[model samples]
Target: MALLIEWKSGGNRFMERCNGALEAEILACVEGIALALHWTMLPFEVETDWLTLTQMLQSREKDLSASAHLVREIRRLIDGDREISARKIHHAQNQYY
Candidate 1:
């Protein structure tokens, strides 16, 4: 839950410093989605322990928070893409933690 993002695909890895947990979570998802898009990896699910973040991304309404742009970008990437989805999981179930 402490701003951690880890991925393993063909020996590739990505990590970045973030100011807070929320930013880290958003950035992680953005990076993951972008990577999936770049690699043409469809039918993937993004799992997160933050229920609010998950709901925000799934909502159709606008987000007026400071991270609205990133949220919108996430929606755009996921919109019309039935192959992509977000799921809320328990913190204990998160593998990256």
Candidate 2:
């Protein structure tokens, strides 16, 4: 399973490029995506519009660790596929960053 980390800013029109929701919800979305993929490596990719989510995953904090662990579990499940990568893809032409 591939993990996609997304950051949704709380209902800020100026920050429209980001999702307007709590971090947990965004993380849940990532988990859901992983489950959908059945923890398969198979060249999977995760994408998020915000850079913060990506950076958070790299942090050493306990909270961050849990989230990262969830993602890692998915990776381990699909160990053989070994083609996972995450990147930011432009939402819509008019969408924010």
Candidate 3:
């Protein structure tokens, strides 16, 4: 199924079209990380319901699949930045605030 990737923080929000749920999740993460870095917000935590995505981000090895580039981009963005991390949350806990 198609997915809508969105990131909302304070008064700022971003939306983007994605082909799938995983891609959407990844893109949303990318947007969030970029924004956090832009705002100079250190010690940022990215909460996600997708366990695979969380694991992928925490992995030490490289991803060589179709979405490898996007995953790599995420790594590039957070590399050497210990202030950023991705955490897995229960699907029910991911509701709108």
Candidate 4:
């Protein structure tokens, strides 16, 4: 479902596992950030292997995809709250992290 790992010096960190829609995982990230990173507005960077989700988030478009609703939820959480960004990277790049 969802998991969170925090480092003494890193503030709050998390890793989530999802076997269903990829958008759910993205939603988890949004929720996690909102709850854990609660404070003055700050920029948060998220890396993902799902290029489609990333594109949707970056473009602020919600349509066609099953995860579109979740994407919209993420956008809502990010709206006027935090600068949350999603970047696409190869799966291999995140394998060891």
Q: Relative to the unseen true structure, what is the C-alpha lDDT of residue 10 in candidate 4, on a scale of 0 to 100?
A: 23
Sort by lDDT, top down from the best: 3, 1, 4, 2
- lDDT by residue (1-97, candidate 2, tens digit) is 5344343333322333333343553555456455646644345555566555555543445554434555455445434545655455554521434
- Tens-place lDDT digits, model 4, residues 1-97: 2232331122333446444757555765666657646753456666677887678888944466766666777777777744556789797865532
lDDT to native, each model: 0.74, 0.48, 0.77, 0.62
Give the TM-score ranking, best first: 3, 1, 4, 2
- Candidate 4's error at 53, in angstroms? 1.1
* lDDT, residue 50, candidate 2: 52
Q: Would you give me the overall lDDT of model 2? A: 0.48
For all predictions, the C-alpha RMSD in Å is 6.7, 8.8, 7.6, 7.6
Tens digits of per-residue lDDT for model 1 on 1-97?
Answer: 1233345333334655556788778887888888876765446777889998898878878788878888988888877745777889898877631
Candidate 2 lDDT at 30 equals 57
Q: Which candidate has the top score in TM-score?
A: 3
Q: What lDDT does candidate 2 reach at residue 44?
A: 54
Q: How many clashing pairs in candidate 1?
A: 0
Q: How badly does each model clash, as a count of residue pairs? A: 0, 4, 0, 0
Native-referenced Cα lDDT, model 4: 0.62
Q: Distance from true position, residue 28, model 2, in Å?
A: 3.3
> Of 1 and 4, which scores higher on TM-score?
1
